[model samples]
Target: MKKILPLSATALAALIALSGCSTDTNGSSMPGMDHGSSAMSTAPPTNVGTETGADHNAADAMFAQSMLPHHSQAVEMSDIMLAKPGMDAKIVSLAKDIKAAQGPEITTMTNFLNSWGESTTMTGNHSMAGMLAGTDLDKLKASQGTEAAKMFLTQMTAHHEGALEMAKIEVSGGKNAEAVTLAKSIVSSQEAEIKAMTELLATL
Candidate 1:
């Protein structure tokens, strides 16, 4: 029979150490590879795809609804210039081409707007088609001879530029694929016309 003394603290510590306490060879606390290294060792988790939201639903529609009649106005102006007397053949030829190209487009886009249930007349409460400012149309109506040709070219060039600008806005901001395609086509065609007009302007 023996009286047992309470275990010393040093003896208990040694007993705990012997029960598999571990430390790095370099005296670091980590018993295995560091957390950062272990984390890096894992294969990167697969990424799930993300959803992209739609943009410019109404603005795209409005731009299309507005631009069709604007294009028609340009075609109409070209027709007027073509019919005017003493017009330069080069200019007249360009006017004819513009009218021919644009008239069909007017019909096409108009059909699109109609199908979309948009307003057709430009003079209503929600007028989108700018049917020419009154003064500008009056000036066009009064012009004749070389003056008419010059005026028409000048006006039409500006008009085409305006369309191109609208087109560019749609290209960058509008989400409708058909509208964007049409806008890019407008840019290409109008830029070519602009170059043609500039050359014609130099001659006059």
Candidate 2:
């Protein structure tokens, strides 16, 4: 009976030790569960697009809005130059390049305004520099040959100058990365074109 009693107590001790081991295993698993929860909680935010999409300011909006009409007028003038007969080959090529470049840019600016929830049209009576008066356009349309080439070059030079002014403003104050990059490109390309036109005017 004494031996039986000690064996019974020994079994009880063994059972208690096994129960303690089970409790320790469960306690260890709790840390892993907590780590998993922490990983989920620290996951990156899902609204990155919203943050990137709103990265524009008033200057960017104005650049897109005001440049839309300015670019359109330039395209119109290029078209008029292209339709004229016996135009200078250089002038014709320049007109074609202007139309090609500004047409896509107009679309890009329109998309920018639309995405920004801003009006595509300029609201005030702000006169854009180098905009041709109807009379000026009439004079350009009436002229022919070298006269037309000279007129187009002179007018386009002024137009490019106005664009450079606007682009410089955008480069200085615009918040959108794409808009600023575009403004820089305009400054570079238009400055070169202006120099070319000046040389062409001298030749004429």
Candidate 3:
């Protein structure tokens, strides 16, 4: 289920402005707002697809670009657990939830990029916070029984923290309203899961 934030319109607009947009009073585009392809200048292209352009920006693009892979890794992690034997029921459920929630988000962000005339593919070498290292994944793959469950929890906690970092960046710097909203949702949902994982970790 999606969590609804209590942010008012004024608050949401204020956040977008703080992200460095320069919208007019009616929340339309500001003429001189920078539209560079960096995270700093994302305001929806003024005339990308519609008769009037969608209100989004580079921060939105970065959020989507970074998050798509981030979410994909999470789903992959979930799949790893699901494919293994003798997993704890609780951990299996958690993995399923993470996979279910993130799969749709990946698609939504893909659509967001397609609509903006932006390539969904990110360029250059980049590192995202919380992604499992190759060795980390290998360790999880090699483990079995309780050790496997323990490894998954430990690794996924770090993974979720990395997601929180990315989401926070999007919340503070993104320009697209929908993108910002998703960022807030990620923060809320993932934080709860982190708590659950922490508690589960203590028992193991």
lDDT of candidate 1 over 71-126, digit per residue (tens): 87887788788778777899789988998888877887676556555565544455
TM-score of 3: 0.74
Q: 1-204, model 3: which lDDT tens digit per residue?
A: 133455566667876664553334333353344344232333344333553235677778888998999899899889999999889999899999999999999999999888777889889887899998888888888888899999999999999999999899989988888889999999999999999999999998
Give lDDT tens digits, candidate 2, residues 1-204. 999999999989976665565466744433444464334433334255456457898889888888898899999999999999888889999999999888998888888877777899988787777788899999998999998999999999999999999999999999999899988988998999999999999999
Which parts of model 3 are misplaced by more than 4 Å? Answer: 1-54
105 in model 3: Cα distance from truth in Å?
Answer: 0.8
Ranking according to lDDT, highest score first:
2, 3, 1
Q: Tell me the spans in candidate 2 whose CA falls farther than 4 Å from its real position.
A: 1-53
* TM-score winner, 1 or 3: 3
* Candidate 2 lDDT for residue 112: 82
All-Cα superposition RMSD per candidate = 17.6, 12.1, 17.7
> What TM-score would each prediction reach against the true structure?
0.65, 0.74, 0.74
Q: State the C-alpha lDDT per candidate.
A: 0.71, 0.85, 0.83
